[model samples]
Target chain A: MRIKKLSLQRSGLAISLGALMLLGACGKKVAPPPPPAPPPEAPAPTASLSATPNAVDPGQPVILAWQTTGATDVSIDSIGPVDPSGQKQVTPTDSTTYHLIAKGAGGSQEATARVTVNSNQGMQSTSNATEEQLFAQNVKDVYFDYDKYDIRASDQGSLQADAQFLQQHSNIRITIEGHSDERGSTEYNLALGTNRADAVKNALVQAGISGSRIKTISYGKEKPFCSVSNETCWQQNRRGHFVYEK
Target chain B: MSNSVRAIYRASLIFGLLFLLAVSSSAQDWIRTGTGLGVERVRLAAADFKGSNSDAKNPELLKTFNDVLWNDLDNAGIFDLVSKSFYPLQEPGQPSEVNFSVWSTPPPNTSMLAFGNLGVASGKVTVQGWLYDVKNTASPQVLGKQYADNATSEAVRVIAHRFADEIIFRLGGGIAGIAETKIYFVSERTGHKEIWVMDYDGANQQPLTKLGGISLSPRISPDGSRLAFSSVTKNGWEIMMYSFDLNRVVSFPRFGGMNLSPSWSPDGKLAISSSRNGYPNIFVMDGSGGNSHRLTNDQGPDVSPTWNRKTGSQIAFVSGRTGLPQIYTMESDGTNVQRMTDQGYAVSPNWAPNGQFLTFSWMRKYGPGEPGSNDLYLMDIASKQWVQLTHDSGRNDFPCWSPDGRHIVFQSHRSGGDQIWSMLADGSNVKQLTFKGSNTQPNWSWK
Candidate 1:
């Protein structure tokens, strides 16, 4: 909820700042710069923008050069405010346009330059991830309470998600590693971990996943995911983790 | 009384006195009182040995020997080891250099003194050791031993351990010493949990398996010829055996379900907790994993079976049939089943070498909001009375008794990691055995 509110406020401020900048350009021109004699009417701002190399490969840098006269403030749309008459280098991941606006005693004048980015072919569909990586990404872990083997009510959703993934991939066999927090003895934790693994296995079976596709092993408290002596770390350590077996 | 009976009684009395002079008739009393059973402790002084020659390895080997000897005796639980600062300026290397009057009085007033000398010649190291009685000036030497081995650091340590055992046996009432025994445990030093072995004094630590996977509950065979442990394999948790002679893992039949914590009966039979029959229960089989017989037909998990090392008639295990894990013992046929623990969680039931007591990890008050710890406890089977061996240090577990029943090797998290530790049977003289990686489930070798 806080994140949503913060982002909304940020966008609202952006809109108001954009409107203020537009109104400054449209309003009466400011007094001309001090000179021996002031001009009868402020000279209308003149602006020109150009890209040194208008086309390039993805992630390549492009140079934007702009010149403006009779303008006190100058800014680019995406690149933020910039010097009135200067060249700036920018790397564009995709094809983009550089929009520069100059405002002064004269009405604001805008100039735009576009940079075309070449797409790298054959890199989109080919994913080199192994089966184990895919398994880790798709399957989730089931957690339990301290010294209790029965699955937690909060973890039911996670177990169901795991079952759904396993059901979709019928040929994949998995090993359920039951782990425990380092509070009790190794032997008792071993048994407790075993029951935890078995409990998950039973849950998955009841959810329509084949029992033959699963195997269980208990690491007891031998291996821990976190080492801190607190509940937050212990909660992470006590889990039924999944591994994909070929 | 008959005349012959009266004459025999007098001769017996004389013989008993001579026996007392040689072996100390109070030996039985000290053995009983050692290890927290009583308060009396024998005052013993160990003097630094004088190097006979200036060989290059003499200093190193002598230091190893002396350190091993001193640690063995001090860890024996029956001796009040006198500090070296109180020793006389002149130490004895041989019987002729003995000055009993100085040792028997004042600062070094010790009843027993152990002094020895080490020398190297012709690529062989020789050690001459003696245990002397400073109180009895006439027959001062109680034990004299000479050992010669190849001039190596390992050989020197072995010789020292042998000499220490000789002294311990004579003074600790015929209960053989455990100074030379080995401890087999699971060490993760190599980035994988594998079986590792170390000397009883924590020297010469080495790994026995390179399976590169998670292995738990390593149980060395009764004869120390093979190691049986549970490892995660292609087929899941199975009982895997490694032969010490072949120096590799030997194949064993895989039980269908999860099999763990394989223990060896005194007669070389194997007992394990297997779920092949639907629920985890105690099962006994031949050493080669043949003739499998399910022992416990309970409703919950029954695991960590340990046999009576002395009688081999009863098997103690951890079961959860009562809603929480507890220690239970059953006969070989699984007929006379009895629950040993009446309170909170208990597991890792290991029978003492003497077959009268069991030492296991217990949490007398388990669950959250309770103020208790998981400590090792020793309980007498007949009386159901137990004594807490460890307190407030860390989670101590998997307490296995040395073959002599004088000491126990277990794992503790006291030093911020799971490491193997050993203490006297009475829970005194605690020593950390393995410092490197996480070590647990230490099984002392039968010998």
Candidate 2:
């Protein structure tokens, strides 16, 4: 969705293009000096984004996370924002976006989070969805090494915890989808992905989960979360998806 | 075990100790530096060599079988030189068959049993073979093939060997698991295909790099520590060095197109292969991935280069400024470019371990529509003579000499599958190394 919006906005204004290089392409390879910087700039001092779970109805224990770029001080004006001196409780009016307010010598800036939220869908995803994620909680992407199927030692601990929770909820069966960066062929990636999922399955199995309870499939180089071809995009794409099923 | 496997096994032992010796095993120690297997999974079955064949077949090819007519089913080595006391028969011709019951059953406790025949003079050769159950010779299992005049003696040898393999494959019981070795090749499988590694039978084939991004002709380094390939990855793809040493990869430092075919510089210092100013040409780089020097400025795609360890100055590669891909050689620094074969189009040249002759592929024009036929050809650089290693079955390309120079592993369509096949260096004793997926690109690990 964001890609479509980005594309439309780019095409509509004929601006900020990446590949076609509307502006950058013209100036390069020639003596033409780069055009002067335009007076209008993007929201440069955009505020940081954050979220905090406030209410808990038996299962929703809130957690706090923030994204900050330009400021050091953050304040919540309604429930009013967090004050170092003690004001900490605030009711979430919408999906939480920690309001960050700050003052710089040159200017003043306030940042708001682009925290969009939707309640967990009726059915959990077969891969890449967490148990708590059923409540629509935030989760980060898991990564893998080139051609490696085993989960990193670092990721194993968290995966173990996830496995334990799944064990507690016996009604759930999960599918671990293996993925790979577009560095190799589709079939090879598929096999590599399968290897990765198998690794994760091994881990879950070793951590007291039954083998039959878990299943796997490799979507080799097919479904990439990130489309760029560089290492970063490859890193994002070389990932195994976790979906919780009930 | 393949000679190189033993060396790698030792090097890896050095590798384990090198781990104990850490810091030094880096480029300075010259260890292979590519990603290695993560964990060890030992399968008693894979390690099982299945031992040699049963020493039971009694009726052997006699010194006297007649020459006869041969085939249509199509198809398709231990050494040592010393005059023996037994007076082996004169060179063979189209051999005739023998019924087991009438054969000269050798004396008891015979130290040696020679059961082979040849039929060269006649328009045909018949190799009559049988499985004498020794104690049960009454119901012997017989098998043999008759070859037509056109059957190169080489095919007879191939047919004969296949006959041997059948006895072994059957007597040895199910699949020797050989039906599974892989073949590695540089295929235009994907346009701009680079050096690719696959099963000896070419099953799970995947490119080592799309990172070479474009065309990258690769050759296994002499020390068996790296793959020296030319790539456009650098800048427009230059030559670069890659080590099979690192257990994990860290050296694929996207070259600026400064690296090219990397024939280990004798002492394993520099690589030799074609590079470009604008075309696929020859160039050399430090085995350590530094100090690259362009050796050839030929306009055509000068490729498939091999290094002569003995002469130091000898470089062999295929150049096409003459219109078609043919074998060409030069001095260490690229001077004295010499064209070796002038007959049929021959390309993909690799040194025959001993370095006397370079193995290459030649296309014969006979089958059908310009029906290009690719066959393995080995030319003796010194003799100015060439020998066709394979024929009729199908195109046999990418010949890699075993480290001992005694055996050569190559890919062929003879078995109706593009699989890797091996034969005596002289092109006798052909055997399929793989039986599964189509395999190609055979780089013999040097001992």
Best by lDDT, which number?
1
Residue lDDT tens for model 1, B107-218: 9899999998999998999999999999999998899999999999999889988998898888877777888899999999999999898999788999988889988889
Provide backbone clash counts, one per model.
Answer: 0, 72
Off-target runs (Cα >4 Å) in candidate 2 are A1-246, B1-76, B79-218, B230-242, B252-261, B269-275, B364-369
Task: Write one digit per residue (lDDT tens) for candidate 1, span A1-246.
Answer: 557555544544443333222221122233422433333577889999999799987667899999999987687766656788999888886556666667666656778787877665313311555556656755778877667778866468667878987887788898888899978666667767777888888999999999999888778787898787755567678889888888
Alpha carbon deviation, residue A163, candidate 1 (Å): 4.8
Residue range A150-186, candidate 2, lDDT tens digits = 5776466557656766677667777777788754222
For each candidate, what TM-score against the reference?
0.73, 0.38
Q: What is the lDDT of residue A125 in candidate 2?
A: 44
Per-candidate iRMS values, in order, are 39.0, 30.2
lDDT by residue (B1-447, candidate 2, tens digit) is 445544554554554443423322322110111101111111100000110122222112121121111110011122111122322233112122323222223222111112334333343444434333323345433333333333254344344444444433343222221222233455555544456665332235566656525444455566656775544431333454555676222354444312344555456655443322334456665666567677777544455567775455678876656654567878878888887866445666777544566787777342112345678876667654555667777777777765545457877778775666776554666777555444455666554
Model 2, total clashes: 72
